[model samples]
Target: MRTTASFHSYATNHRLVFGDISSDPKTAIAKANTINGGKNGPFRAFIVVGKVFTKNNFEEVNGALQDGSVSVDLPMFFTDGEGLPEDSATNQTDVVDIAPNVTFLNQWGRLMTDDFIIQNATSGSNDRKTAPTDILITDKWPSNLPRLSKVGFAVPQTAERATNNDKTIDATSKDASPLYHFSGSESFWEREPFANEAGKHTRFIGLAPFGGKQRWHYAFTLKKDDTSTPVNATECPYLKEDKVEEEPLKRANEDDGDPMAKKPRIAPSDCFLCLSNPNLAAHLVVSIGQESYMAMAKGPLLPGHVMLIPIKHNPDFCTESRPSTNPRHRHPVRFVSPKLALELRKYQIALKQMHPGGVVFYEIAKAKGVHVHQQAVPIPQEKINNVENLREFFIKEAKECGFRMENNGELRDDQTNYFRIEFPNSDPIVIKLNRQNPKFDVTWPRKLLAQWFFGNKERGDWRNCSQTEAEETEAADKIKGDFETFDFTR
Candidate 1:
């Protein structure tokens, strides 16, 4: 993970030296020193947008460090731009402190200045703790941010850039509002500080390689109210062009490049349950709802085994969590979203009404190939009294598997990795499993319990008892007959 260091109480008047010093560190240091009034200047830090040293200039850096010409007390933060070192050690960690005050901000690392939260351009892991800041520093500008129509920066080629370009920037939020965004592009570009319609200000500046005759140096004073009110994209002076470039009109006689030349839609590569693929058994859908749907299981664990899945692709059952207000609770409440929770409850009700024996709902929220789905296995009436015994068996099995079984009151949503809910208003049994351990199989506990319940190991797997197309259709028909009158809409 990328690390962040904040510098509080930094003087507003403190100057920040920004440039690419990879070609010549000696001259860069000399220029910085001169700009800071010959060594004792008011400069608080040096922000290097690109690499600090090139392949051929290693000796120059060595000489600069050996001569003690650079100030040791001043903080120097450098980001690895497009030109990253090939060494493995530098790429392994997010941030590395090479010297007392010299830090390398590996891609995506953040350096929190008094007035700005500077971040490099890299798709890092999600971190919710860091707060938004006034200015943002990145090597490559995010396409979601306001773009300059006249600027000559090369069009972004990354897939994320294309995806971000389709999203609207939320200018009102502090996380999106930045007074200045300094980046390093393929060419030199600059957009003078301008405010949008709502009075939010931003100055975009992109520096080319060092030593060009074109404009490179920029100086600005940090203001207290830099990001007070947010602005809209329409108000930005450098907003991108809205209309597409004109194209030659196609002749009426000629076919206009295949009237039906639209690309075919494809299912998500990660999700196997998406109904887009005709080859998949989506034809066996028993009942469809606004948020979720029910389908006959591919393999029957019982006479009427079925699965409930979300219409939209959800990675797992517990996708969101919130702090609980329960006065007696010691842990945060972990539950699905309101819509998903309601849908699950509805599915449980429908399944219980159809299967009088009993319904066992089990879910594993790990990174398994199995898309988020709850398995509803019907227990015969004779075996319904043994449900409590099965619950005890699960607890004992979980303990043997090194998982700490927690009561619903004690389990935090974030800590829960597995859970089982019995139909007819039974309490959910949450299990805290270690996600980091490779040997920790999330599907084992339920599979073992299912085997014990069914008395046959093969019964745990639905694929082992594959149903014929006609049988699947019959099952779907029966399920639909039972739930046709039920309300499953959002």
Candidate 2:
């Protein structure tokens, strides 16, 4: 894995140089001296996108380091490349200080200057705090980051030889990919720097490999405000379209040559909580939102017991890993969108207002056949004091269950295995459970508390006290009457 370190400073204009170099240290040093001699001389740094040292080139590298004429004054950074010798002292995470001002960026790392930020595409730990990056340099292009370049490069199937026809060029291009400089592929030339899709005047220049026939070196002046505008839909032209081919329909004659043959049908989900199934009591629905709906619990933990469930089937309120190609790849909160969050909050507020005794939102995300739902039970005014000890009890119970409690009560990494939120006031008390424990059940907290307060084991399970159609309808009518005026949309 590769890690990144960011350095930030303020400056009006900063000049940085970029180029590709091989194991020949003399050439690397000469290029630096040549750039120094130019009007844009004495650059902030020199970024080498290829191998800095080869297995048999230690003598030349050592001679360059010893010679004062070839000494590099500005910081020189280089990433991993083919033919580079492995340093026993430096690991993937550790950056090697080769010379006075030259640094090996390892497999993956980041370098930031007053004018720009440079990052490599190796997965690793990140510094707790960092600044935004301007330029991204990696061995292989990152599929997730904003595309700042108009040209796209991909390795051809036939690696024995490089061909221009194998590379696809899009003349009508638009993207915000940063000024990316990369090597290790077939060397190509760009006559002029191309502007980003955002029309921010930011440019991308691909540096050809060292000793290539065409241009191999690149240098440009960078301004503090040369940053790209945020990428929009039209700007991201590199997004791949999902091509799902429809399955061919089978002819009736194919099935034993019988036109009357019937196709196998999928059975409906047996879980009554799933709204899609016939077993679900639609009459119990109290309020419906875009992403979630509220319904009367099958068995009343209390008269106002309600379940908040997502409209779509979700196992739990935890962060899910999505493909990089997806625009919504980042983890969400309880719901996938802010609109869902607002809807849920509205219901919570309305429920609390209807039952001022106080509402306790509890969820057991690990239950079998569970369609993620939170059990919102209104606590009696007299039992409000007992609820204070509830947090302490659960903390002790979690420790006994062999799960360490995080100091912060908030969800960790968006994994909401078991959590209890007290309404009206106070922060939520969340418990991340150990999924490996077969004996552990997330529902135990709510079940035990219900037994202690209501003194009815049957009340803990909704199935134990199933309501008739008439009874469910009555409960739903009463809930709707109480909650209709409090709808957030209104």
Candidate 3:
């Protein structure tokens, strides 16, 4: 419906380019070059359009324009299910699936849902409409109008045409220069010459995805120069996440001050977490790596408990959280670099090896912002299989602690504050720490871990487990020596 509405708007304004049929789509499109070499010609741009053939929607927002409004990039592939900004929940509620394998939920959380979308459909146009260009199947015709889109799930389609054996599509988006290619089994080719003048028999405004070889009606033809770029593609706010695919990452700063305000910012020299801080407890330092470091727990819950901290001032989630190109988005969606994540996971593995029983890594992310630290504490080996049992306990305790716990069984893209807990051999648990609970107890997780895993509720309070400087220094040296063989940084 979104694509169809957009196509209707474009066809109404650019009737001449869309309504008129070319005995040869190529020759007629070639004519575009005659006008400013068709810089802003009838062939707006090349596009790969997805047609949604649901009974709920029948419209196709046809072709694309070169105004950088046309999009040719692959929508990207996912590993089954992953939370992403702009990604709409594809689970259907109102509709029922007749498949024997899966049962219908008949639930009602989703307000809007769609069925039968050709994810391969392109919505924008290209400059060289005459070349072996990408295939777009938005409504029936391509014209100069803004393209509209919504987050939904669909199986996309494309014409099997390509320029080389590599069979790659250079569908770099005007809005975003990402998605170089999708798997190339099918090749793309130019629209054939109606196969022996197929145009004389009948005309197709554009091919419809339903009713077996169907098309829509056309209107009057009037051509004029529409050198304007397609309106900007729909914009979705950038969100940071712990688990993300290979996408663009961005952010300037989380400065809430007025544009002109000269609010003082914390510097590494003064930050307690920074290695440069003069007041730092140097005796607690365990080992340092290129991008991260390990330090003994400030207040030891257990003798071997320690923290993995990023050397840079990153807040654990976003790698490119420093600068942003698009000002409209206060935060860019790309984050969770695989390389960095792999290293961090390796760090966790090292800790796990040191403790044959079990280990839990908990990171408290404050809504306001602070340097991130992943604290690894030991969990009894006998209790490893029972980690899932803690799920309900954590949830019940969270409410009493002044915050809510939401476990849709996936990691959320939290820009502000969230508490992440990875129990022994289980997927991480995340609880939102909304700013409303400013006085929320951050130490609550440690309390639970101490009681359930450490077998001592008293040690849950870090202050109770405090050690002297000399004792901490001696422990740190022993820890560095003990962990050297397992530490990847070494």
- Residue 488 CA error for candidate 2 (Å)? 2.7
Count of backbone collisions in candidate 1 = 1
Clashes of 3: 38
Model 3 segments more than 4 A misplaced:
1-265, 322-338, 381-388, 399-402, 435-439, 454-456
Clashing pairs in 1: 299-462
lDDT of 1 by residue, 1-490 (tens): 2122222223344546465777666677667657655423445666666777776776556556656755444667778633445576477554667556677777645555433455544432221112234445554554444443444435435453344322112221223345666665545566545554224566667666566654445555556344454342234543333101001111111324442211112224323477654335665687777678888776567666788887765446655556669976554454567787788789888778777767777765532223578878777666787666776666676677666556562455342344444543466666543432223443464466556676745555333355656776787777667767663552
Candidate 1: Cα lDDT at 425: 42
Error of 3 at 350 (Å): 1.5
Candidate 3 TM-score, true structure as reference: 0.43
Worst 10 residues of 3 by lDDT: 195-204
Give TM-scores for every candidate, taking all chains together and pairing residue i with residue i.
0.40, 0.40, 0.43
**What is the RMSD of candidate 1?**
22.9
Comparison by TM-score, 2 against 3, better one: 3
Q: 1-490, model 3: which lDDT tens digit per residue?
A: 3366655444333221121211222332233234312223222222211211122221111122223232222121111111111112334222232122111112111111111111121223221111110121222222111122332212133332112111011121112211111111121211111110100111112322112222211222222121222243233222212111111111112335333222113445545467886656777777777667789986688778899877766544454444457788664454556666677788888888988777878887542244668898876666767877766667777677766555563555544356778766556667655444444555678878777766656677554565657777888888888898898886
